[model samples]
Target: MGIDDITKKAQEFLGDDKVKDALKSEQAEGVSDKLLDGVADAANKVTGGKFADQIDGARDAADKSVGNE
Candidate 1:
């Protein structure tokens, strides 16, 4: 799936409020590049590295949505 699709799925799974809270908390705490790397790593592991690009794009879109970018 594409980034938008992944984002939509995540939102659906996690709920908007939870997602917003996570984003806000992360932003307030100052997310590190290493954290993003960890996210990528987790995504890669979850998908067996088959959809790495899509996961990266989704992560970027999620960050943008949360006003981090």
Candidate 2:
């Protein structure tokens, strides 16, 4: 299959009711968000605030990758 086909399939999975319910039940989104936020914050502090903006973008991309965005 092509990239488009894979993308479509992934979208379908992300939208599935069963999958959605499972994710909600497990609090996957909330947990992941909190965890990512903490990591980003720590990284920013470690870097002396040099990559705060870039870290936000990376965090958003990570969330989207896991169907949280």
Candidate 3:
């Protein structure tokens, strides 16, 4: 299968209700927070803090998507 096909399949799997529910679990919240924080931090460092605000906003949006307030 092509890379695009694999990506589409992965997206479909993640879009499933069961997968969404799993990502919304309380345990997932903690893990998501740590993961998002680390990603944002890494992004900020890579950009030399020039895009810190934007990166943080994007991180918050991603966190909310996983059901975290």
| TM-scores, each model vs. reference | 0.44, 0.59, 0.83
Q: Against the true structure, candidate 3 has what lDDT?
A: 0.92
Give the backbone clash total of model 3.
0
User: Taking the tens digit of each residue's C-alpha lDDT, what string does model 3 give over 1-69?
Assistant: 999999999999999999989888988899989999999999999999999999999999999987545
Candidate with top TM-score is 3
Q: How many clashes does each candidate structure show, in the order listed?
A: 0, 0, 0
Error of 1 at 44 (Å): 0.4
lDDT of 2: 0.82
10 residues in a row with least lDDT, candidate 1: 25-34
Candidate with better lDDT, 2 vs 3? 3
- Cα lDDT listed for each candidate: 0.72, 0.82, 0.92
Query: Ranking under lDDT, best-scoring first?
Result: 3, 2, 1
* Best of the two (1, 2) by TM-score: 2
Off by over 4 Å in 3: none
Clash list (residue pairs), candidate 1: none
lDDT, candidate 2, 1-69, per-residue tens: 999999999999989988877665547777878888999999999999999899999998887655344
Worst 10 residues of 2 by lDDT: 60-69
